[model samples]
Target: MSELMKIQENLRETARKLLANGEASLVIGYALGSEVSRVVPAFISREDEVDRLVWNPLCINNLAKYLLDYRHEPGKVAVVVKGCDSRAIIRLLQDNQITREKVIILGIPCPGLINPDLVAARLDPGAQITVAAVSKQDFSLQTGEGTFTFTRDEALLKKCRDCEQHTPVIADFMLGEEIPPNDPGDPFVAVKTLEELPVEERSAYWDKQFSRCLRCYACRNVCPACTCRECVFDQAEPCWVAKANNLPENTAFHLIRAFHVAGRCVDCGECERVCPVNIPLSLLNRKILKDMKDLFNVPTPGTSLEELPPLGAFTKSDPDEFM
Candidate 1:
């Protein structure tokens, strides 16, 4: 068995024990989606159903967001997380959205996820994946029709390119042997490249991206940092943001949402992935993240529970630039 298959089997067994022993009332993992190239979040409450659990390069959903759904429930919830998704777990814990005692984290040292769109373009329609293997430099997929391979650089998710956290920083249970960490390359390369553009050019670039937005709010909805019970966009009385899909309203939504999660956004890149129009929301979030790192010397939010957000905490030695 490949490492992924081994992990998948281990995950199922772990989840089964958790549910059977009453340790967890719910186990959230990924299962094969109806489509050939898709994997959907699976919610398993019964031990018998644990066989449905799966792990693959396509298990891309940030399962931590679903923990919010069960936060107030009576029993504990177990969740599977990759390095990026594990950050969301920390975000929830720090925000007090979910208590640590109430959730069990099953962390996986992710190799990386493939770009579904890129895979879809290469595969025949409805081609079923039989197996997948990951190596240091590429991933091979054995489909019903044939085996296809792509270099990590060619097929890995954009967020994975500069991934600093391949292994989860926190986990109640680790599902597999720890994978070696990748070199912490320039995490802000995209943001810095965009910053190099002229002021008007930058504005035009964002305007174009925002203009294509369908206002489906998939980005906001999928965002683990966006845990507001009543989001400002949903308000009707004062109407902080209009429901219209025009550029001004869209711009307002994006900017306000970004600032709201400025210190809290874990950079899971879910917002960018779920976006139908393919807005580079990660770039926007990372730009703010770079600023926070430069100004406050704060480590990334969600990396640790003890570290207070730069905006959430007051420090005596803080720079007095504004003062």
Candidate 2:
């Protein structure tokens, strides 16, 4: 069997068994979408639905975030995961939100996922397009114009371009071609340049950037970790920040959102993807992430559930920045 087929077949067999045994109510994984290059998450509730599951480069949505639905009953589920996704699952376990055994994981070595939307915008601006495949630095896409090749750097999600993990850190049943582990280094060169700027320059820089906020709060709403029953943004009695679209409030809103995620964010880059204004909010989170590593020497909170939340834990050597 071709390696790809073997990976897909292996996962389907697992899904079929899980469904047949009633071990899970759903198997959340990507399926071919109606779009030319679309991959949609399938909530497979039956063995027959296993046919729709697919493994490919275009499967970019972080399905782990969907588990935040408040009404989901207590039962096991199956989820497909990549390297970074393992960290997300670990974080959920650390919080005692989801038990380790509740979900069957199909871990796969993640090379990287290309950002289709970014490609569409840079070239066609408003054209409909789908990524057919990505082989290292080149991405093939079917656009309104025709099929084309684009450099991966131009189309890759910023976080993915700097991704430090290529192999699944945790898995019950892994699929796809095995790849070597990626270097776990400070990959935030661009963010570091921004941080090196003077405080006044940084303030002025984000002023123009955050000014574009529409107060849509799509970032917070789509986040899996922001699963509070009632978000602080909606609370107006105490008025933590104004509901208006002013720059000050917008800055506070973005800052607070990043601060809240400090060590907990899994760096799925969902907040950046969901933002309509095209803000690079992940930079803020990465700043804190660097501090979490340098100052506390802690693995970013969600990287593993064995450790407590960085802010939730205290030690003698902790940095005085938060003090």
Tens-digit lDDT track of model 2 for 1-323: 43445667778888999889998778888887665455687788899989788775667777776665522667787888877777777766666667677777778777677665655455554444432455667766555778677687676656576675666667788777777765746667868999899999999989998999898988887675676777888998889998888999999998988888887887777788778998888888888888778777887566665677778777776767756
Model 1 TM-score relative to the real fold: 0.96
User: Stretches of candidate 2 above 4 Å error?
Assistant: 70-72, 118-155, 319-323
Clashing pairs in 2: none
| TM-score (C-alpha, index-matched) for candidate 2 | 0.86
Query: Least lDDT summed over 10 consecutive residues: which range in candidate 1?
Result: 123-132
Choose the strongest candidate by TM-score. Answer: 1
Model 2: which ten-residue window has the lowest total lDDT?
125-134
Q: Per-candidate TM vs. native?
A: 0.96, 0.86
**lDDT, candidate 1, 1-323, per-residue tens:** 89988898899999999999999999999987877678899999998899888888888899999999999889999999999889899998888899999999999989998988778788775776778889988888888789888888889987787776888879999998898777867898888999999999999999999998888989999998899999999999899998989999999999999999999999998898889878999999999999999999988888887888889888898889888
Error of 1 at 280 (Å): 1.1
